[model samples]
Target: MFIEHPSQALNSLFRDKPYQGVNPEEAKFLFIGLDANYEAQIDAKPIFAKLREYHKDGAAFWRSHQVHHPFLLPQYSGDGRFYHRSFARIGFTPEHANQVSFIELLHLPTVGRSSLVPADLNEEHLSKLSQIVLAGTAQHIFVPQAVARLMHATGRFAWLLKRPSEQFGPLGILYRQQAKTVYSHLHFSVYGKFEARKINEATAIRSLISAGI
Candidate 1:
């Protein structure tokens, strides 16, 4: 189900917050998602309340979340949970994970793929997202395909849809000029196989980052 908005408590608490992660301005990589995710049994209110308390410190936020969040658990480079596996495939080491930042286009934690669509974003939300992205200093930006498409359609992030791009498997590389940072358009789950060929898109993305492309 699509949530028009999170609970009043959550909205009021984090209305002004735009991103998550440690030292976003200094981080080398950014992993952007649609929103926070939680299972049916999880109560978002208290979870987010704690999240807000640790908002000022990304490291603490992540460390605390590791206690109950399965996604934060360690995984090897392949054949594990999709979330951490994709992280590994993208060249994100455990230490490197702390070095990167993760931002969500929307607030509220939900189970499964989010039902929140692009049209749900109002002008205020769009402005905040644009400002956050344009101001961030991360050299490598990884944006999910759905979020990228949403931004493109809204014209808030059309710069990512420009040329000087390359398509590798399911990933589309959109080179940004600001500080030579690159925006990678990737699968929503960040894991997929190219139907036309046998290529691991996440690994390809990591290779691109390694090649300094």
Candidate 2:
């Protein structure tokens, strides 16, 4: 959890925009599942850095912008590891309570006795996650289903494959497209491909609100 000041160019790219009447407190919590390997990469640093910068900015941008609701990083340390250690606890003070909390799903280290086990969705941790969301402490959960699936297929989480395509815009574009064919089964509002392509941070925030996340 290294925090870096945003450069002028980065600041200009994320300048605050006019609010369309959306309130931050009322905004839905967006839980973002970051790929561990992807996050470790040098290029991906900017994305996380930008997210941190946006939250620290604390202006109108804070009002309209949705924080990465509960940042869940997978744990990858310790011998005979059975659980994922949270990065929030590893890099930053775990006591800094806020509207959002990030959880890191720890993975097994490469040199460990065994490879990282698949995250147990049925575990008490997940039950607690649901409780946290139900308590209004959390808003919405965003898991990169594609990345999760890939991780399931392969024992390792590949960073390059998990990186979002900036050639488009906010990573939500990829989610929106997939939401149509596969995600539609979840019964959430299915914004069409045309609408999905237009998603940005603001639009994603609105969608989370509209979806009742």
Candidate 3:
């Protein structure tokens, strides 16, 4: 089996916030996913691959490359073939990809051929994940409906999404808040009435945030 980011894996197990340098307030949108695409990430993008090699020396490399810090993230080199297009559904453009905030539920990239989210994800990984995500103060937070379900199954952070108030703001939106976060869910990466659905979701999110509900 091919070892992917052997060094990065070691670092994540120790680092509570593997993505340390990014500030939640700076992010326009906080995107949460189960993990990363290791094959496409390490094999195709030299800059991202640096996460593996650089973290071994401490967080220098990862911090340097963070998109929101001082630089903009160009579309990943292999974006057309590798990166998912669903982001466009949520108002993220190639330009916004740089300011794009990301939090992986599991920081460890799966080894060769292993699925991203296993049936039994490690509890330690899940625990820190809750902290990293909850600590963020982003105005908008999004995760796939699938991710909501999985988190619910574990009974951990599901409470974050349970309350939706009838008190909608100007644009006909409703929301529920948790600590520093204002979050909602959608069918991420599951294609359907692509343009229309995203417009609706984006509108609601904007309204909710603006209303401060």
Leading candidate by lDDT: 1
- Clashing residue pairs, backbone N/CA/C < 3 A, model 1: none
**Residue 120 alpha-carbon offset, candidate 2, angstroms:** 7.4
| Ranked candidates, highest TM-score first | 1, 3, 2
Clashing pairs in 3: none
lDDT agreement of model 3 with the native? 0.48
Residue 114 lDDT in candidate 2:
22
Q: With candidate 2 superimposed using the best TM-score fit, by how many Å does residue 4's alpha carbon deviate from the native?
A: 23
Shift of residue 78 alpha carbon in model 2, Å: 26
Report the C-alpha lDDT of model 2 over 27-127, residue by residue, as the tens digit.
Answer: 23333332122222322443455434433442332334332211222222222121112111112122222333333233110121223335422244333
Q: What digit string (tens of lDDT, one per residue) describes model 3 on residues 112-195?
A: 554444445667767756655656456556666555556766677754554443422312112344444444455444445555
Model 1 stretches with alpha carbons more than 4 Å out: 4-18, 44-56, 60-70, 74-81, 111-113, 162-164, 167-170, 188-199, 207-213
Candidate lDDT (C-alpha), each: 0.55, 0.30, 0.48
Q: Which stretches of candidate 2 lie over 4 Å from their true place?
A: 1-28, 34-101, 107-124, 147-202, 207-213
lDDT over C-alpha atoms for residue 78 of model 3 = 44
Candidate 2 structure, TM-score to reference: 0.28
